[model samples]
Target chain A: MPEKRQMHLGQQLTRAGRWSRAGITSGPAALWLGIFLALPLAAILAISFLTRGEYGGVELPFTFDSYKRLAGFGELGFDSLYPVVLGRSLALGMATAVLCLAAALPLAFFIARLSEKYKGAALTLVVIPFWTNLLIRTYAWQILFSPNRWLTVAAHSLGIGTAGEALYPGTLAVLTGMVCDFLPFMVLPLYASVEKMDWTLAEAAADLGADRWRVFRHALLPQIWPGLGAGFILVFLPATGQFVIPDLLGGAKTAMLGNVIQQQFASSRDWPFGSAIAAVALLLVLVGLAIFQRKGSKHEVLP
Target chain B: MKINTPLLNRHFCAVVFSAFLFAGAAQAEKSTLNLFIWSEYIDPQIVSAFEKQFDCKVNIDLYEDVDSMLAKIQGGGAGLYDVVVPSDNLVPVMMKQNLLAPLRHENIPNLKNLGEKFVSPAYDSKNRFTVAYQWGTVGLLARKTAGQPLPDSWACIFDPAKSAGSFMLIDSVRDQVGAALKYQGHSVNSIIPSELKAARDLCIAAKSRSVGFDGSVGVKNKILAKTAQVGIVYSGEGVRAMVDDTNTTYIIPKEGSVIWVDNLAVLAKAPHRDLAEKFLNFILDARIGAQLSAYTQFATPNQAARAFIKPLDLENHAIYPLPEVTDRLEFLNDLGFKLRLYDEVWTQIKTR
Candidate 1:
């Protein structure tokens, strides 16, 4: 009877240990995401299907009208407004991420190649912009691009813009502000990978009669694939949904997806529609991540 | 065996810290009155004075536009704020939604100070649910260069042929869209899809040619900086801008535009209803009303307060437009369900 009782006690302990191991590691994160992330996402998805309330809140009678409206179907007819906006945002996000990648690659390499003593200082310089308020920095850009400022004056002299006019409230300025804001996100991740890269592999490729392009494609790229993908996402998603930089730097001529989402929630009071826009954006991001995980993150040689 | 003790400790700390924060928030101040209104609409001195008189803390929250204000109230913020200042057209809608609590006549004795005309506005007749706070028209704020004629109509912003360079659409949906609607000779609250479509097209075309949309103050800044020649702005901001720099002027526009009365009312589920009424009553006082008007540069509805108001403000044509201009001005009507038309059009204009 003592042996049987001991065996039963051991069995109970074994079962508890299995759960405790998993429960301890993932329990907090699962619970945290379940309540904060997953639940809100579920609620947004639910609300997206519900009808818009008369008072500009959500109500009953579920419909896909929001998604339909998003797909360029409006009461006035099939206008390209939403689709155009989504396309514009996609372009902005893609452009910003590509620009960041172009800017960050060399800078990341430069920082990683810096003597040990200068590495921290260079990294700090990259991150100093983060310390300042984004709004303030954007305003500073506005001032710098003002007619009185040297940059705009120089641009005017160089025949880029009219004399006595600000260089901002335009697309170029928006892109500049976006690049400035997101460059750090791109650089830090890239620098981490670039620093750990085995330079010998690149040298070996070159030594074997491979050109510089081949060396980078075969040796360097495979090493930094994770960082490049991470940085692209880190920049792209936020850039796509970003309203502030576009609002401040770009002329408020056209609303980005973020601005549209804000309008729906605020002035439009169409919470259900807003939720649909948001849910779509979220779904797009998830789809993008999945695609990137499958294809973009894989080590590939340029064929 | 490896242990995750530090990770465990970090998570434990986070839990305790969050719990502490919750406990601290639960012990909020008593006798606190939350006032929700347009930014810079209220005078800080009056707020402080009221706070001292009632031995209570007044928390002020600001909204830039009517829709945002309504959105907040309807989005479970009904029980959060004690008082909210909403525009005239919104009163009927708020009433239908049960967003407002009828004023307790006994609690707000200072309602007597309101002008006869203001006492019973069409939007909130009999002053049942709201008290008139201020009345003003939305108009063009233009920087009149020495050589150029000032922008004198909604056409200045909305019409391509009559375009003033680099104009910004004001952030308020009703006011700016109302301007466009007026320019097209439609009612400011026109629910007709075709008319709204016309207005929407005009706005989008103008937007591409002009500077983007901004708040009234931002528009004023654009005019002042000469980055923009004209912008849509509220009467108060327009008036203030005119004073700050003599080169600028505010006008009611040739086609006429929205004339709105912003009213103060307690939320139906106001957490501090009693205090909200007190705040309303205090606002209605002759001296306080005049002070509020002088600071905001908007027209005061307090009849008794007029004697205390600055004659300079009273005489300003922008504050009180001419009779002929008043003849054409329209008050925005609550379209109820038809508001969706404008909403869709606005979204189109914005996104496009």
Candidate 2:
């Protein structure tokens, strides 16, 4: 019994040591999030409730007029932002998520299927594009999509409809740019999960007379669901807040919430309203992140 | 043993903490000058010229446009820059906000070289707070070889079928909205909501047809590339484009465009005020002015440098218009609090 107690004490000490190390590692991260993210976010939330100044800065006194303005929109047979910019942001986010998933899945699978020899080369190809500035890549896309440009030129010969002036800046260019920018974000995370997938389970499922699709659905998918969830989170969150691509590729006529927030701060000089809008965007992001966590954990099909 | 242990740990922590503090203090003592200016406007040669002359480290910061520059400056505690080149219209607003340091004109002997016309602009009447570095008017830049008669109006931007999705306009709030207001025969500084609403509508219409709402520099590139047959650009950039690319031509709109002047000002918290003044005076030299003018191809404000301009290029109405043409133009002043209304309207038009 004494020996057992000693063993138990040793186990407890080992666990404590591990916990202490984790606490140390997380200290810098926590401090960073606390200062850079949490503090600014709290200020933004506080300011959003305040009145907007004439020059668009925040007024000293508090006022709920901004929220009340949104409330007034509810009486007009719609949620203030329904069928407006928010709705468009949501629609664009969903389309971008779908597009990113479709592109990322194949690339992740191909990299995962590599015989452990060419994996580094293939993964490097995926990551190397990200090293270049995203805006520069988006601008390169502009050159490609311009009328009579190389991409459109090839499309013309291939009888693709994107040949002429039809390929100019608009929704299509913005969507394509978003897909290109976020594809790697989805792939890297999915690759980590997919590469670690239990190949034996898939083989066992096939051995049991299951077809490829069934094996993929029942065995492979369960192993990679966490990666899919991570990829979805990675792609969905930033796509919702995308600014540069929409500004550069979408033309001035098509703007997102990011553009609106930027205008509020710079052009409007209305930090309060900008902060309010930012607060709302932050809330939406938090809500999204919460839903993502719940869905990710709840749907884990592990044995 | 336990007491000794805590004491030793505390001593070690204090030593490490002191080391970091000392390092940080040492780093802070180094003198540095941070200059924030429009991208490509500050000639790299000038920066190297100053660095070589002064031996004091100069950090050159470039901003894509004025709004981004203002955003950083107004953010308070950015500590990222010491000197800024803001437009003339911004001078009054910055002065009213106490964001600028009063210039010591005596230290800057080149202040005398600035043409009297630039010295007495409404934004800074005495030119005490800011020194005018470069001045240009908003004008039409068209493709010369494309055979489109020089566009003398902002109407071309609003006319879709012709200039649709192939033209550029200044992305700035004052210039973009102000141009629309001028085109509609309304005062550019009108605070009246109805006139603003009209300007907003016209911009929305114009944006629907525009290839891009870009900076003055980008518009200059568009004109050079011939990707855009016409652009609303700075007169200086327009002149440079016409000179560099034979296909490009510039014309001041008959109705008029927003004439802007960029000024060199010391920030209120400028730590290197003496250095800032030295740099300011260096650019004021007539020979330096001539070099900048030759490269940028803008109208030189220095009388001595005016003779350096080729006669044909000087006669180009787009580069240096006749006196009568200059008479019809107006300078943009601080819009004050009305900037918010313009931004809100611009956002509505852009997002919609």
Candidate 3:
């Protein structure tokens, strides 16, 4: 009788746990992800295999010419396009990632060390810039960099003419905007992980006569590895597909992959080519995710 | 589980009810008119007047670019918009796709108010389904010089050494190509590759010199700002700029320029045909036509409206281009599938 009662109680607890987890599942969030992400991705994939209409829209006939064109299968200098665009995108994404990581790390650490009462306020400061539209901010940068603007006047006064010219509408402005926009994405996860850390191990290292550097290296470093890894992935994913910054801040000289794909569909009306480029961008993102997952697992597992 | 059962049922029922309501509303709207056009081109006063006069709802949506408007129409969302404003070149394509309703002249008496000069063009012969709203030519808007010669040819603007990073060209393929063709003393509609190649070469040579490719409005603003000494822009917009700030002067190039006309056409499947016709009639009234021109600062095709304006406004050579200037202009035609070729060349020039 006693054993049977214990089994029934265990079953009830298990059911209650399952119910609680299911209750936390937000219907609106799931629906939003379904409609926006999954539906659009499926539509793009479907359109990519179709032939181009005479007027440059999608036709029903299935063809692989777009992918073949991207591969530069038969044409002269066609193959060069893939590597050129891919190289530029990769360089930009990598630079943005490094900038974001560097800018976010110290800020996140300071937030983690703050009292719980002040932590939210400190974190909110990092996120306030994101509330404003990215395009508006980019345009503001444009205004500041224009020859007629006061920034130019100041630059001339300081003998920084070349730097000011380089700062306005191209690589530098884009990097600045990317770092500003995505730094919060890097910081939040890191703060959460760092705040939840067990400090007892660090104390034990110190009790054993280890110096502060040694204690940090042996005890503190290992715990925060996962957070750093997560922050890196969070910042890297969206930065890879960054569009507005490059379009607004980056001048005509710097055409990112996002700009090219946008032109292919919007102005050029070349769907197959656009889809082919979009497919490449998707594949790059997925590969990045896979690598991040692998790295996370390698560091996180404590056999 | 028991506690949440009603909640789950309520959520499901709410979703089902909302879906049904949306579906019903979509089907119920059988008389709505959807007009998609350029932003700031059409006056809200005109739309409201038509709505009040016709006793029908007027749905006006705006787009930033004409190409984007064409994309939406072509993207199988034709049901989303009933009326669309397309430039002269796109009308034939729209007609070929059977997207337009044949204009019934008897229903629209204001069609007669348009000048004879606008009745026929290269894009649509016989003015089948289109009614000309406003017509303008791409020409040189030069600054008044104390001593320097006023450039009468496109060459002075396209010259690399003289005009690099200082001149403004129209931000469009057809217009840009036309400018290059005009500079070379060739017809704007020349589809000949050798001539096109020459145009492309000229465009490439002018790239380093160009401040940027800008639209008519931007070109006008640049001229007013005195940032751009010369710009290739529509005559009407340039005239408005000159009126706002008197330092600007406009002239049609002696070689040639492209004339562009924006036409108003009703869609074949327009849900609110009665309202659309009423709007057309309202724009056709000479007094209303003059009012619209005043609001939008665009040239009016209504001959009667010209008589109503002051001498200063009428005598502005940019707005009322002289007979010889009008004769020298050519209207752009539908390049058909050759649009892709032109786009590719333009993209290469712009990007490289």
* Candidate number with greatest DockQ: 1
RMSD of 1: 5.8
Question: Each prediction's Cα lDDT score?
Answer: 0.87, 0.75, 0.73
> RMSD in Å for candidate 2, one decimal?
5.9
DockQ of 3: 0.21
Q: What is the lDDT of residue B250 in candidate 2?
A: 79
Error of 3 at A258 (Å): 3.2
lDDT of 3: 0.73
Better of 2 and 3 by TM-score: 2
Which regions of candidate 3 are displaced past 4 Å? A1-39, A71-83, A148-150, A156-159, A162-167, A197-240, A301-303, B1-33, B140-152, B168-170, B186-198, B219-229
Query: What tens-digit string does per-residue lDDT give for candidate 2 at A1-303?
Result: 434423443354567766776789898899899999889888887887887644234566787755553332322222343226665776788799999999999889889998878999998998898889998999898788777887888877888654465354678788899999888889998999998888999888999999999998889887888888888888888898788888777665665777777877776666776776667766777897888787767655556
What's the C-alpha lDDT at position A210 in model 1? 97
lDDT of 3 by residue, B1-352 (tens): 9989999999999999999999898756535568888887777888777767665677789986767777777777576776778888778877877888887777888777888777765677777788778777888787777777778788776775454235776766788888899888888877776777778778877765655566777677766766568888877677777778776777788888988788888887776666676667678788888877776666788887777756666676777778888888888776655555565456446555
Local accuracy of candidate 2 as per-residue lDDT tens digits, B161-264: 44523688777777888888888777777777788878878888777767777778777886676667788888878878866887777787667667667888
User: Considering summed lDDT, which 10 consecutive residues are worst modelled in model 3 chain A?
Assistant: A72-81
The top-ranked prediction according to TM-score is 1
RMSD in angstroms between candidate 3 and the native structure over all alpha carbons: 6.4
Per-candidate TM-scores read: 0.91, 0.86, 0.81
Error of 1 at A166 (Å): 1.7
